[model samples]
Target chain A: MSTTRRVVIEPLTRVEGHGKVTIRLDSAGEVESARLHVVEFRGFERFIQGRPYWEMPVAVQRLCGICPVSHHLAAAKAMDGIVGVDELTPTAEKVRRLMHYGQIFQSHALHFFHLSSPDLLFGFDSDPATRNVIGVAGAFPELARQGILMRKYGQEVIQATAGKKVHGTGAIPGGVNRSLTSAERVELAADIPRQKRWAAEAVAIARDYTLENLAFATEFAAFPSNHLGLVRPDGTFDLYDGVLRAVDESGEKILNDVEAGRYADVLVEEVRPWSYMKFPFLRELGPHKGWYRVGPLARLAVCERIATPEAEAARVQFDEAMGGRPGTMSLAYHWARMIETLSAIEEIEQLLDDPDIEGDDLVRKGERRPESVGVIEAPRGTLFHHYVVADDDTVMRANLIVSTTSNNEPMNRAVESVAKKFLTGTEITEGLLNHVEVAIRAYDPCLSCATHALGKMPLVIEIQDAGGRTLAEGKRNS
Target chain B: MSESFTFYIDGVPVEAAPGMTILDAAQAAGIWIPRLCWHEELEPFGGCRVCTVKMNGRSCAACTQPAEPESVVENDSVALREWRKALVELLFAEGNHFCMACEKSGSCELQALAYRLGIAAPRFEHRWQAREVDASHADVLIDRNRCILCARCVRASRDLDGKNVFGFTGRGPERRVAVNSDARLRDTDLDVSDRAVDICPVGAIIRKGVGFTVPIGARRYDGAPIGSDVESANDELESANEHTEGGAAATVRQEE
Candidate 1:
């Protein structure tokens, strides 16, 4: 027996930005099939079609202030193809690659340590008032400070290149709008080794967390018949561009080198009646048999190696989680994120050391051309932007594949697995659902980018007692 | 693509770059086309429509029309007056174009454009759209009716800002900027430096801070509609010994 309960989330106040999560467990004491409902979509995909081709980098970068550099780079890649001006000065590309790495450092730190770490380490049920970084700050201020400095390093790289953070206006199609100074590169090089040590220590802390015995299936791997690669001979780690590959549990390649524009062929979105998000799968394998995951865990399995020394050491430990061949394990995603964080930092440093980055004429003014797709392996997953332009260089059409859309299926599957394991017969604790939500947040789905929206932050979860009296409820305003 | 053509502006004949917009050409020639909706950082949107100049016999928005041969653009002059006048009229009558009620009153683009054009009153009948002020956002607010369908804010959200936080819904005068996710901007991943606020031609879009700091004077489009009318109102400050033609010419300077 279930009674109707209307719980209104009044603008979830003071959180990340905008979002709420709502969960309804039937009277039968089971998730009547959970729904990850995203009530908001910013409509970025729809309106961006008519935008001037030249301004794509600055325009799309504003989609989310948090990861402006990534969006800026992706849009630049798409615009680069539209303009057909590929005299990409080595220094420009290097600075771009470096700025991108800085973004990875900051964003990964934010998502893993700040957003997802609290739930995993402190346990999600640890007092709402005490559940924040400040709550953790009293105990783990060093960790928090490390995350902030790492993020600042990335922001500084962007500032050095473009001018400021947020809407830095750094990456431009054909090349970057601004160039970096040799002095900036020197500073970046000096900072990387220090960051590398911090990442090393962070990885140590992450590796120590044993997520086993959490009641979830530690052995069940989703469509593990594919190894993934993002812009490399094999998926080792290529940030700017890559084709997504899926391998099976036994570690055999099912999908290899494929173009990103045709990514829709492999990722078929499944729209659950309950979720605003559509699940993605390997289309060639068929949905009935296709299940794949992207982002850090998926990336670790797809790539053959991590290019940086500090990260490679951590990769070995991360690789060990997948039985040495990059298998599918939900908890292993956290470990992979830390290792990639190290790789991302080292890669940025290497890019900074390049000498050709100081030239001012990096971008060709008023140059635009045909259709092209900018493909990159976002720290979350494979990201692709396909832009079709007119002969006059006006953008006619655009199709974007965001990290959230790629991970939607795996996220749901993981959530279901976790829910069935823990919440099947229990007190319907908030901590259990928080864990499940963190699993989805681990992918750091840019729903704002996926839907091409103005903004969206939907995390609506409702709770009530056995007699239908309100016990406690929490809403996601951020 | 149209064949390349040549055009003249301000007495100089120039070759029009193939497939170039008028704004692009003007920019290439080091000519500054004073604009609100057209930003280098954002996708070109002819929302404010203030950049309209006489090309052929007819006036067209500089941002929307292509730059081609056999076309002439007059940024300032009698021809520019008619366009600016009409442009001000539309901005005045549309939504709640109440210059007096706004804090961005004097410095408002619509008001400044009007003073430049010498609009005695909004000649057109006002079709005041019932609008609301959404103060939900921490930094900014959306004044619905004051907005002229110029998509500067939307462009800023998508192009320069990358927030994709605000957009236009419906079509024509029924058009309005809606926050993404249909929630107040406070609910979205948005900030005040949003280009939307930057491009608002009227008092419709104003930043939370710096409201009413400057006083407004003159009537509609005379001394100053944009907050501090220092540039346009300088003549009035020294009207006693000032050249009588000076005030009129200054208005003409802004008109073109």
Candidate 2:
């Protein structure tokens, strides 16, 4: 069977943004190769020229409403660096970290619990009518409720700390302007215990699930650690203020102290005329072959230790599943996220009780900067924000490298593996192609964030036989 | 417990009982809560909900709630808290808050809070209710859609100004803080200094054409706590009404 077939998914709708996927089959309509397409274009870098310094926060935060807090905080930190305000008053730093925690807690929960799990827990063909979390609620009500409750608690911290959740005015250039009282603190403090429980449950569930999928791990796995977030010596995650380190599957830190200023030297971005998204690869690995990843799962692999207890335990669970060392299995990435959620909760609780936060001396009134860069471990991956400003405080230029762009190479490998394994020499069938898309979905690629702003399937097939010689190749959208 | 303590608030201090209201102490100190529906001139009315505060225990309506033992109650806390978010959510859901489309965005307490709190979207669905805009008075225009039920207009109409020119016509989210005479503002016996204009929080009751004259950033409540702005707000309202059809707006001027 050497027939060629085509599966094309255009204007990938329903996700946060957009993308396209193309599948090619052989002569007998058997599969040949699979290519995932990312499409959408907006030149935020070229577009941010000639804006005011203080005004950049308002503008960059709009880049992603889902993680506005992180963007704003990172932007603030970069501006601080640019203006030489390295020492943030105790209260401002405390508030800044607390709000940053809010972003992590919410964004990760939305992904691991709400977005991706709908498929993993529910099973793809469990009747579309009852295939959502609402359906999951009908079946596993407690798990679903716990998921939502944890999300609510995380969002509540954001709301209580910032006066509102999505777009908060809590982060100012020099420092924060708002203060929290003891009563609000006590009220907020009460949510920690409940949050802790949900994180534990999530971790436990991830552990059990990973144990079930051994072949997917031991046989087919690919992750390059050459580029990812670095944890600090203090053990806490270094998202907003930290170093960038990339590792290979063999536990090697090839690059270290890759500061935001030098990101261009090590990282190279290229564009495909077919798709709008620009792919970023590790220079050492070079071009299409430079396989790298970012975000939570990539973070755990590169770091030496997790500062918090829950996260440490989750790391242990990962080691146990991988037999002493967790390699590059995408399935285990789900469990790793659970560990991250736990780490976020514990860190937030400790931050809320910081003594420095209780006193004054947060903001320094007027401390404008000339230029700066901000970076954070966005849930999908690592997000970077760079800004240049004139003496007039207006923005001169802006560039952003969304997290999903980094994982481009490895994600392609996954699709290539799945397509090759399932469709090596058979007639192209619908179910096989749908399975290809699922593998990519497993990465949870946020196309909406990837192109700097801007799939279908089918059935099973027959036995080995000399099949009809397929003519020209065509792509199908199901 | 009865010993008087000196406290400085916006440059004013007044002695109060161990359990007296900060709003009351401010009034005694001549600091004023600048509240709506609150009358030292009459019985306390909490419906205005504009006199909310941040006390030691929790945020509460200052008109109906008391002060803590040692801490001063601030209304900004109430205006920016969960209750305020919910209250604003309720207000937004109850009425249409289209700023660019409405005449009150710059002067609207609702819009000001949205900007202050960074509320980009109204959490709940807008009611989209079509309200009556009564222009019966030769000079006064009553737009029921803009009424936030702070009751400043209602209380000012009946108690202080004694014109009885306004009263709330309905209840709940549907309540209309309305004019009493059922006539346009200009057709009533109401004078320009009527407290109704003073008590109005949003631009529901302006003297007309003063909407764009003052820059939104420098308005009275910019730095003032939410409910606390009501008292001083009346004087501004009274002054605004006194200049009815007169020209005065700082950077800009209302219609002549």
Candidate 3:
């Protein structure tokens, strides 16, 4: 008789939201298949229905604490369309851009220094008790301090532009509500040199770590997939606002320069039975072959060049390190994320120098539209917010595709790749499970944003044979 | 003209005209007694009870109670403070006051009053009851979810605008601001310029398209607590009175 067994890793850690991995093995103890299950559901899209259209920008910020600014800006952009304002005043646009860059810089800094550094500094198989930000601080005190300060500087920038740190009312429909005062500009500019230096140092650290672990990093959950992001009309990197672009594994444009409003025409979301998250794929390529990757790795692959000098140079070095090919390594996400952080700092410096950011002409309005879409490159991936407003000014319908939701398929693929490569026996060991978590962390998935759910679930792992008798079990809450 | 009388509130003598309510007398003397349903331009309804004070050891709504000669009234006692705080808390629990996203967050009288009362969160169980929103009006929106049954709009429309566009419909917890028309603010003759449109102490009645226009920090009560203007005015008046009294006493001594 053929015998099969299953291993379940419940409540995956070191990532945002609640998720679990189930690995099934064949009769010979060979890994058969793996699936990542998102256990929570919020129905946030349904909750926003019937609310006033103007409230969307602030209301949607409740989606995720880690990326509230992303939702705020995305919903604001969509509402900008509802009010019929195609082009914002220079001051308004620059202020919004400054807020976006601050968000990306701070979010990246937090993920690297607080969340992912533990794995890189201590090996994946290291003891769980000593593999966290606290451990990193204890050993690498100066680096850890730099991380905290960098995150703080970025948050200060956000506070100045967005009004407060959380659920800011800065980006309103039509245009931004306020602009940076001269004093605010001066204060933020004072630390630009220091921020730039730290950002560059971060890039070097990620680059060195990836290059040194070339053999393991290259094949860890690595696969060929399409990349997607937003780019300026001139094909340079743009995070806040731009036309949508997608490139295949070989760096060939599959969808080029599509307006955000026309995204539904080229991309469609597919629902699977096992997970609450939706899988978005390119329409022309079909779901089977159209699953793509997003976020820092994808942005680095899709953009032609970085606009900032220091980041542009780092991008060149990255491309050379990859042998002038499209980067498919999941571990390289850390390196790509640091490069974007440097680019955001450089952009912040330029914005502070421009006097337009302090101008009083902050809002403009035109003919109103009934339907609109807003797309932005959130730190994790491309985020989409679409809304239909009724004549009474209430939202008729709302559909949000958060960054983590866009990376659902890729995350599953990553987990499967790691599980197949690491599982050696019926017993699920801690070090082996960490390998699976490390792959998922590379994507920086925000399950809360994806599922729109509240609260956390305790971690539990169980291994069972075909008869359902438990062979091994482990549990954790932190 | 009738003769005025004097009364002591919290040990401070306040002068009042014949037929003036305690709240009116306090306001005329530049003292803020914190009333919600009593607008200077409209008649006092005394519905909110946020201005309840002890008059001669009896609890009375300051906005409606007549000022009596030599009457002792306690306005800011510990018991009164706790009573007022509980009233405010009940008001918060009775409505879906989502202050975080409310357009009137910084300027709402209810929110400002809560801040002044030092009530961070409501103690009562929140009644998340379903409320109707009337957005059919071209220039006005009535989001009843935020209504505290203040009756400011009801009086403003009936007494000030002479349109009588608003009135109350239900009793107790069911009470809500209702338009004169069968349904919706648009069906009524209420105009965007009517006093009723701006009379709502909360966000229940708002002019459409004007919400959240003023940045947060620049809103009405962002810099100071709700009745600080009245308190500061009282301070200036008392100082001027002291100076005048000192000069008059010096003159009398020289004449003697």
Candidate 4:
């Protein structure tokens, strides 16, 4: 007699966009393989066709409301190539970089303090009813308020610099439209010290909780995987502008200082029948060995130093405490996220102090070209917006490789690793299932940005027998 | 004429001055009647029919109808709101009104009306009509896809600027706004400072030098819905005038 089973976690909660987890169990009730499936698709690429290249920046920003700046800047950078502007003016460069930093801070604050902290502080097995940001607010009101305020400050910067927090139209091809005003500068700078303090406290909290769980840190959702990020030519962390960098699991550099536009030469996307999300891998290593992670943890692992002084100090401590090599633990992503937030705040302060940030020469004009590519480090990971335009400058083809899609293969691996370690029997418990979610959450995947879904995410989990009969199920929201 | 004529919209009584259209009188009474092609500065065109209201049990275009004495006007009924929403959806489906990409997004009256009506998705199938963008002008671009045939530009050119540089061509689905010259905008007398350039109710007419000068969040319609002040009598003109024509895209930045 043979026995087989399957487990599914549908509409995973506390994450952007829709997703499901499926685990196959062998006849002996042992784990076979697990997969994280992205279920929704918005054909942004197909619809973006025929739009003028000048419109790409504004249009692509609508891909995800949460990370519109990432898309906005990336598309603008690609548009820079189309207009034949190899480098932006010094003022334009600073303004765009400031906008990018603001986005990273807000998005990371949202994920860490609001989404991930509930599980880290309350324990994953805690009641699903009280295990959310509301629960966090009930327990630690000040922390919750700080998180909201931090996010607000970031939004205010985006509004001042780019135009709006959600889909600001400040960025354009070649350069930005306007520079920061003195009044706006002073207003944003006034809150800088307070924001830096909050970021520091958040980082301290992440360090403590993440360091406490060594076994889970090293094992759960943690596996040997390649890492990808962007770094300045001098080997420092850069979120807004830099060359592509890739490293293997051992922290050895595989590719360094590669132009972001040439991403196709180094990375290739693999499509699986089961999901709309494409798994991107390194061209030389193939899918299995090429699977790598991109984001906070990967960024921390790939960069030698962070530019900001305070964030650099935090990085040193994180490296010393979380094992010297970059890929020591997976949960360290939380710590990296906090550090990145701190760096973003510090960068904001730095940009404000510089007099060139108010320069009136905001735009640069150049000869038009037929095709170009834009790449930037989104809060999640590296984002690419490629466009081919006609002589009339209308878009002919568009290809986008978002951060979450690039991490699809490794996200699946993390889910599989967690399932195999925690789930053993035919029957599944809530605690074990939460472990799977925790593993996935460690990466802070934004499925909404990944698949470009248009609806709110409602998470669900189900366990079934080999015959596809439902045996057990759990749901958060329909 | 001494006694103001009274009308009720959504059961609220409103007074109208003599010779005032129902739409204009409704604005004076702080009642919002959704409209297109009815700029306060320009003569009413009533081409789009977005401000359709039921007057004494019969449908009428509010912008073109004079407010009569003791008139019962129904403007905010559920059926009318749905009708306006459907019309906006049809206009959206009929054109490539990609709000995400359009330079006139926040300030676009059509997009603002759609947002005001809470239109998440259109009920009609998108025609994906192929349209032409004439960028031959030294400083103006005419993208026909975003036009809703409001004719504000043509009137502005003829009456305000006296350039007579714009006209309508074709009919029905094939009908479109066109430059007066056979060649392009460059051949016509239209300049960056022309009244016709900034009077467009949609992204159809935009200045070349400025695409995103005001940024998305700080644009005229970002915070308040279109005509929020005119209909509400709140006077948001102070904030609205700060960024109206200073930026690159010198299109319609004020509510008409």
Best by lDDT: 3
Over A1-478, each residue of candidate 3 has an lDDT whose tens digit, in order, gives 4478778888787787788878887777888888888889999789777778888888888787777889999999999999999989999999999999999999999899988999999999899998989999999999999999999988888888888776778888988899999999999999999999999999999999999999998779998899888999888999998898999999899988898779899999999998888899999999988889999999988898999999999999998887776788999999999999999999999999999999999999878799999999999989999999989888889889888887888888998898888885545679888888888888988888898975553455777777766677777764
lDDT of 3 by residue, B1-256 (tens): 9889999888889999888999988887876787778788888788889899999999999999999999999987778878988998898898998887788887888887877766766699999988988889888888999998888888888888998998889888898889998888889999999998898888988887665667767787767667666766788654543432223323332221
Q: Please write out the lDDT profile of model 4 over residues A386-410, one tens digit for every residue.
A: 9998755568898999999988987
Docking class of 1: incorrect
- Candidate 4: chain B TM-score equals 0.88
Model 1: DockQ against the native?
0.03
> What docking grade applies to model 2?
incorrect
B73-154, model 1: which lDDT tens digit per residue?
7765665657667866876787776443354544566655555456666689888676655656656666675777667777
Which window of 10 residues has the lowest lDDT sum in candidate 3 chain A?
A454-463
- List iRMS (one decimal) for every candidate: 16.7, 14.6, 1.2, 2.7
Q: CA lDDT of A66 in candidate 4?
A: 83
Quote the chain B TM-score of every prediction: 0.73, 0.65, 0.90, 0.88
lDDT for B71 (candidate 3): 96
Model 1, A1-478: lDDT tens digits are 4453322232222223344444445556665444344555665666556434655666666667677777778887777777675547676677678777777788788777677666665775676566666766777888878877877877777677655655655666667656766777677678877888888877877677634532342632222434354747655667766665677766677777677656666667676664455666677777766766767777777777777788887888767755787556666667778888888878876776666666665655334457877877666667677788654334678777677667666655665666556666577555665666665665576666555444545455566644556646666545
Looking at model 2, residue A335 earns an lDDT score of: 77
Backbone clash pairs for candidate 4 read A10-A460, A11-A459, A163-B217, A164-B217, A169-B216, B210-B248, B210-B249
For candidate 1, give the lDDT. 0.63
